[model samples]
Target: MLLQLDCLSTCLTSSGSVLFPITAGGGSLDCFSACQTMGYGQILHRHGNEEDRVHLNVGGVRHQVDPDMLLRFPHTRLGRLLLCQSEAAILELCDDYSPAEREYYFDRNPRVFLCVLNFYHTGCVHMMEELCVFSFSQEIEYWGIQELHLGPCCGNWYHERKDYIEDGDWDIRSDDQQHPSLDSSFEELSALDKDLAKFKGAWCGDLRSYIWLRLEDPGHSTASKIIAVASLSVVLTSIVAMCVHSMPEFQRVDDNEKPIEDPVLTVLEEICIACFSVEFIIRLIVAPSRRKFLGNPLNIIDVASILPFYATLALETADEEAAEENEDIENVGKVVQVLRLMRVLRILKLARHSIGLRALGATVRHSYHEVGLLLLFLSVGISIFSALIYSAEREVEHTDLGTIPSGWWWATITMTTVGFGDTCPVTPAGKIVATLCIICGLLVVALPITIIFNKFSKYYQRNKAMEGQFAESIDFMSSVIISTRTNRYQTDSQDVKDVFFSRSSCS
Candidate 1:
C-alpha cells in the first residue's frame, strides 16, 4: 500500500497536478502544508475546476480570465508562477484559497497587464495611447518580456527609450510631472549634457579631460581637428628642420669656426619647440595623476625629444666659452651635434594623431609572435650559413669570410639580397651556402609581412565599421530631435489659435 501511494504521488506530480495525500477516512490532512510546498497549488486547483473561470485583481480592476490562457506564456514570470509546474511564488496567500473558489491578486497597473495578456494570447504587445514608451518599457521588463516581442511602433519607442537611458537623460523626479512640453525640453537639454560630458574625464573639474580629447580622441569637433592638424604640422616642420640641419652645408669647418645655421630653419625650430613646450607644460599641470602621465611611453618620448634641444643649446654655449679660453672643445661640439640629431625622433609624435600610422603600430604589436618566429628561423639560418661559409673560405687568401663573425656579415647581406659587394664568398661551396641563405631570407621575410598586413587590414576594417555606425546613430538622433521640435511647434500654434477664438466668442 505504501509503494502504491508513492507511485500515485510521482504520477500526479509528473502530470502537472498538486501532490496532496488522501486518507482512507476521506478527510484531507496537511492540505495547507502540501499547498505551501507545491508553491502553485492554488493555481492548479483554480485551473482544475473547468466549470468556473479564474478572476485576477490587477490594480483594482477585475479581469475574468481562462486559466489555460494564463499558461500561454509559460516561459515568462507570471506564466511560470501560474502554471503549477514551476517553483515561482504566485501569491502570499497560497494556503488561503477555498476548495470551491479562488481569486488571484496582483498590484500591477491594469493597463500594462492588459498589454501583457494580449502578448500571451497573440504573441504581440501594443503600447496604448495613454502610456509613455519609458513607462511601458519598464512594465514590459518587469513582466519578463523581451522588447523584441513588441510591434513596430512599440519597438521603435523601445529603442528610443534605450537611447535616452544610455545618454543618461531620464530623471526620476520628473516622472511625477504632467507637463509634456517642459519635460521634452528638459530631456533634450539632458541629452546635450551627456554628449558634452564625453569630452570630460571621470572626475569633475579635471582639465586633463579636455586636453586628452583634443590630443587623443579622433572626434569630428572643430577644436579637436584643429589641434590634430596643428600638431601634425609642427611634427613635419621639425623633421624638415632636422633634415636640413644634417646637410653638409650646415656642418662646422673647425673648432674655432661656428656652424652657419640657416635663419629660416632656426626660426622654424624655435617656433616648433615653443609650441611643444607649451603643450607639454599644460599637460603636466592639468594631469590628474602625475606619476601615470610620466609613466606613459609616449609622454616619455615627448619629454625626451624636447630635452635634447635644450641640451644642445647648453653644450654649444659651453663649447663657445671653451674656444674663447683656447681649451680643447672638439669633443664637446660633437656631443652637441649628437644631441641635435636626436631631436629628429620627434617625428614619431605624428603617430598619435594619424590613424593609419597608429593602425600600423597596432598591427606590429599584435603580430609579435609571428614576427618572433620568423626572426628565430632567420637567426638559425644565418648561423648555419655563416659557419659553412667560414669553413669554405678560410683557406682562401685575403677573404672577408675568413672568420665566423666576418662570415655572418656576408650571410646577412646575401640573405637580404643586398649584395653590398664589399664582402663575398669566392669558393664554390661558399657560393652554394650563400644561395641557400638568400632563399631562406626571402621565405622568412615574407611571413612577418603577411601577418602584419592581415592584422592591419582587419583593424582598419573594424575602425571603418565603427565610424559608420557612429555616424548613423548621430543622424538618427538628430532626426528624432527635429521631429520632436516640429510637433511641439504645431501644438503651441494650435493652443494659441484656440485661445484667440475663445476670447473672440466671449467678446
Candidate 2:
C-alpha cells in the first residue's frame, strides 16, 4: 500500500497543474523559477515580430511549436506578464486551474503545447504544465489521455465580450474532449515519466534597453590639440609671470635696465589666455547646470585666471595715498603672485582633457611597480655610498660626512653628477673613496634613468599609434555625418538657403 501511494504521488507530480488561481485583470505573480527549469525561454505574448523574446516550456514535457501558428497568436498579455513583467494590469482578469484537470489534458491533447487557466485576472493566464513530443517518448508504455482546458475554476465568471472566463462559466472541456489519446500499454510509468520530463522556460529581456547613456562625441580631436595648446599657454604664461615676480632678477630690474622680452612669448601668452577665457565662457553656457562649471577643475582654472587679473586692476586703482597708509595693498601683491603661479598646474588639463593624453597617463600609472623597483635599488645605492664615505672621512677628516645624513648629501650630488665641489676630502683614503663612489653612482643612477626613459619612449610610440587610429575613426564618422547632412540639404536646397540667410541676418 505504501509503495502504491508513492507511485501515485510520483505520477501526480509528473503531470503539470496550475499551482494558483490567476485573478482577472489583477497582476502576474512571478514564475521565473518554474520557467527557467522548463525547456523554453520567458513567456512573452505580444503581436508582431518578437524574435528577440525568450521562449518558455512546461516541465516534464517537450514539443516544437509551429512558427506560423506561433506568429498568428503572437503574444498575449499573460505571456508578456510571465516573461517581461510588463502589462501587469492586463493579467488581473485571468484564473488558475487544478492538478487533476491538467493531468487529463496532458493525456488527451497532443497538439496542446501549454495550457493556461484564467482566474479573476483579466489578461493574465496561469500556465499549466506543458506537454511536448519529448514528454511523449517517455510515456510510450502508459495508457492515458492528455486533455487540456483553460477554464475558470469556481467563481461565476462571465464576459459580455470576453468576460465569461472571470465568472467561471466559460467551459473549455469540449475543446479538451477533441484531443488525442495518450499511449498506456504497460505498467511501469516511472521510467517513461523520468525520461520525458523537462523543466519550465523563462524570458530574457532586450540588452540594449538597459543602456541609456548618450555621451556626446569628443568631436575632431584636432579641437583637443587646439584647446590643450591654448590652455597650456595660459597656464605657463601665468606661471612665468609669478616666477619673475618672485625671482631677485625681476625684482631688481629697473625700467632703464630691463632685459629684452621675447615678442613671440608675449603674443603666445595673450592668445592662449584669450582663447581659454572664451572657451571657458562657452563651456559654462553648455554646462548642464551653472554649479557644474564652478565644480569642474578646468572651469575653476579659467575663473581663477580671470579673477586675479580683475582683482589686480581693482587693487591698483584704489586710493594711492590711502593704500600707502595701509599695508593691505602690499599684501595683495603676494596673493596675486600665488594665484598666478597656480595656473601652471592647469597644464595637467592637457592630459586630463584629451583621450590620447589620458591613455598615456594610464600607461605611466601602470608602470609604477617597475619604477618602484628602480627606486628601491637607488635607495640601496645611496645607503652604500653614504657608508663608504662615512667610513673613509669620519676618523681623521673631521668633516660633515661623520653623520649618515650629511654623507647622503654628498651621495646625492655624486649620483646626480651635480658635483657642486663645495665639500672635498683632503685625505688620500677619503679622495680614493670619493673617486670610487662617483664611478659606482654614475652606473647605478644611469640604469634606472635608462629604464625609465625606455618605458616612456615606448609609451610615446604606442600613444602616437593610438592617436592615428582615433583620428581615422573620427574622420570616418565625420564623413558619414557630413555626407548624410549634405544629401539631406541638397534634397531641400531652397529650405537650406532660406534658413542659412535668416541665421546670418540674426547674427
Candidate 3:
C-alpha cells in the first residue's frame, strides 16, 4: 500500500558522508523516503494500522516507515498506486541517459540503497533490479568514461587519450607500395597537369604528410570518378531513352500491317542492347557476389532486355525458321524500349531516400488496418457493381455483352462511374438499373474511405497527446535529477572545505 501521512518525523544524525543536506537543497530536495523494516510476512501477520511503524531491515540498515514521505514526494505516492506505470517512467528516464550511467550509479551505492531510492522517488524496485543485471563488458567499461558516466564538463578528460590506450603506434604504415611516387617522368606538362600530378603524388614518403593530404581532400581519387561517371551516365541514358521512347515505332501497330524491316530502327535497338549488356557485365564484375546481382530488380531488368538479343544470333545459326519466329514475336525486342517508362520511378526512389518519405511510410505501415478496411470496402463495391452489371447486361446480345467476364469489364467501368460507352446497358430497364447501381456504388465506395480516414485521425490525435505527455514527464525527470546531482556536488565541496580547514588548524 502507498504510504499516506499518518505520522511524520525527521532524524538529524551525522553519517559516513553527506550526499545532500537535510534542508535548503532547494525545490523539494529536503524530501525523505518511507521505508518498511519488517518483511511482507511480518506485515501480513501483525496486520498493523496505517499509523503503525513497520521497521523493515532493508540491506543492513533498519528503516522506520515515515508516512509523511509519501506526502512530500507525490510522484512516489502516485507510483505506488501502479508499480508498472512508475516502472515505465523510470525506464524512460533511464533511456535518456545511457546504461553506463545506471551501472556507475549502481556501483557507487548498495543494491538495497538503489532499490530504496527507486521505490521512494520513482516507486519501482524492478527498475533497480534491471539496472543491476546489466553486465559491464570491456567496451561498455571504456564507454563508461564519457559524459553519460562522468560530469558533462569532464568529457575530454576521459575521451582525450582513448585511442592511445587501444593501440599505440597502430597507424604506422608498413608498405611503401601503398604510397604514391613523387617524381613524374613527363617533364613537358602543362600547369594544370603539373598541379593535378603533384596532388596525386603528394602522399608519397612520410606517414604524417600522407595523413595530412588525405585529411585535406578525403575521397580525392575514387569519389570524384564515381560522381562524374554516374552523372554522365544518368544524363546520357535519359536523353537517349527520351529519343527512343518518342520514336514512331512506340505507337500501336495495326494487326493486319506487315512488319517493317527498318535498318535504322534495328541499328538503334542493337546499340541500346549492347550498352545495356555492358552495364550488366560491369555490375556483375564489380558486385561482391553474383547472387547479389541476380537479386537486384533493375539488374534483372537490364539482363532481360539485353540477353535475349544475344540469344537470337545463336538461334539464327541453328535454324532460320526459329529466328524468324522469334522476330515475329510481338514485344520480344521491346524490353529496352520499355526502360524509358522507368525514368519516372526515379522520383519515387528519391522519395524513399528522404526522411519525410520514411516517416510517411512508417505512418502508413502502422495504419495498415485502416488502409485494409478502406480497400475491403472498395472491393465490396466492385463485387456488387460487377454482379449488378452481369445481371443487367446479359440481355444485350449484339452489343458485345459476351460473357460474365466481359460483363465484369463493363462493371468496372460503370462502378468507377467512368461511363466509357464502350459497353453500355442497351434495354430501358437495364439503363434504369445502371443509373441506380451507379448512385449506390458511389455511396458504398465512400463508406470505408470515411471510416478509415476517421480512424487514422483519431490515431494521429492520440499519438500527439502521448507525445506531449512524454515531453512533460521528460522535463520533470530532468529537473529532479539535475537538482539531486547539484545538491550532492555542493555537499561534497563543503565537506572538502571543512576537512582542509581542520587539517590546517592541526598543522
Candidate 4:
C-alpha cells in the first residue's frame, strides 16, 4: 500500500525541475544505488514513475535515496522535500548548498538520520545506544513518527526509560531554560547547586524525598554512606550469628532432655531482625512509589530475611513441651527451619551496592536462554546414556549399574567426569558408553558456557557504559533541546518540518 499524498499540494519545491534529476548541461541525470537494495515490493514504481534519485547531504553524511521511498510516507519532511519538483526548492533546504553540485543539504544529526533513513526503507523506527533516548524520542516526534511505530528493540528501551524517568532517576529538563543567562538566573544558581538539583530528583519539593534519597542512594550524602555501612554491618552480624548458633558447642541439653538454643546467639539474631524490620518499614514509608518499592527484588529479600526469624519463633513457641512428644509439631518445626534458610538469600541484598554483583545478577538474568539450553542438553544426555550404560552392564552379575535409575546417577557423574569410583561399569561395553558420554557432555556443556560467558561480557560492558554515559547524556540534552531560536524557518510550515534521527538502532 502507498502512503496517501494528501499534502502533495503542500510541497513547495515539487515543481517540474525537481521531479527527475538532470545534468547541468540539460541531459537526464545518471545515478545508481550502490548500497544493497532490500525487500520485495512494487512500492518502488507504485506511482508509475521509472525512478527518481536525489543526491542528499544530511549534515555531512550523504546518501543517494530513492524518491519513491520518501513517497511511502508523504506527510514526512523528506517526502515533501523530494515531492517539490524544482531545483530552487532543494536549494532552500540549506544556506550553504552549492547549486552547481545539485546536492540538497540539510543540517541535522547524521546518526539520527541513519535511523530515519532506515525507517523510510523499512517502515519501522529504531534508536541508537550512543544517543540519549530523550534525544531519540524528540527526533521521532520531529519526523512525524508515532511511538507505536518503534521497532520491538527500541520500544523496550523506550518503555524502560519511561518507567525509570518516572522514578526520578533522570532529570526531565527543557531546552528553553538552558541558554546562557548572565542576569538573575546564572548569578543565583551555582554550578554545585545545579548538580545537586539534578541528582535531587523531581520529588525535591517533598520533605520525604530527602529521607528517601538517604536510604535509596548511598552516594547522596555522608548520612547515606553511613546508612549503607551500617546496613552492611547488620547483614554481616546476622550471618555470623546464624553460623555460630549452628555450632555443636551452642547446643545445650536442658532438664527435660530437649536441646535449647544459645541465648547469646538468639539475642544477636533478634537484634539483626529488628534492624532489618525497621529499615524496611522506613523505606516503604518514604518510597516515591509504594508499589515499586514493594515489588523490588532487594526489598523482597529484606522481607524474606525478616519473616524467617518470626516464623521460627512462632513455631518454637506454639508448644515447647509438646515438641518432643508430638511428631506433627516436630516435622512442622523442621519445615520452618528450612524456611529460615531463605535468610541466606539476604547476601543478594549486597547487589544493591556492588556493581560487580549487579553485573553478575544481570548476566544471570539475560543468560536464561543459554541456561535453559544447558539443562535441555543435560537432560537428553542423561536419559540416553543412562539407558545405554544400563543395557551394557545388565548382562553381568554383581554389577553396580543395578537398574536404569541407578545408571542415571552413574551417567550424571560420568558425563560431568566426576568419577566418584563408587559406581562404575566393569564391562568393556559399559566403559565405552561412559567414554562416549563424557565426550558428549563436554561438547554440550562447553557450548552453553561460551554463550553465557559472552552474554556476561556484553551485560557487564553495558552496565559499565551506563555509569560514564549518564552524565554525558545529561549535558548533551541541552544541545538537542527544541527551541524557537532555531535558525531554520518555513514560509509554508505545513509543507515541511525539522526531524532528528541516527544509527546502530538500539541493539
Candidates in order: C-alpha RMSD to true structure:
15.0, 25.0, 23.4, 18.5
- Model 3, residue 426: displacement in angstroms? 4.6
User: Which runs of model 3 end up more than 4 angstroms from their true locations?
Assistant: 1-46, 49-261, 288-294, 321-379, 390-404, 426-507
Q: What digit string (tens of lDDT, one per residue) describes model 3 on residues 456-476?
A: 454445444543443354345
Rank by TM-score, descending?
A: 4, 1, 2, 3
lDDT of model number 3: 0.43
- The TM-score measured for candidate 2 stands at 0.40
Clashes of 3: 6
How high is the CA lDDT of each candidate model?
Answer: 0.67, 0.46, 0.43, 0.66
The prediction achieving the highest TM-score against the true structure is: 4
Each candidate structure's count of clashing pairs: 0, 70, 6, 12
- Mind sharing the TM-score for model 3? 0.36
Query: What's model 4's TM-score?
Result: 0.55
lDDT of 1 by residue, 75-194 (tens): 775565565544234443232323334456666778889898888788888878678777887888877888878888777776776676643442323234423322233454454345
Error of 2 at 266 (Å): 9.6
Task: TM-score for candidate 1, please give it.
Answer: 0.50
By lDDT: ranked, best first:
1, 4, 2, 3
Between the candidate structures 2 and 3, which one is better when assessed by TM-score? Answer: 2
TM-score of each: 0.50, 0.40, 0.36, 0.55
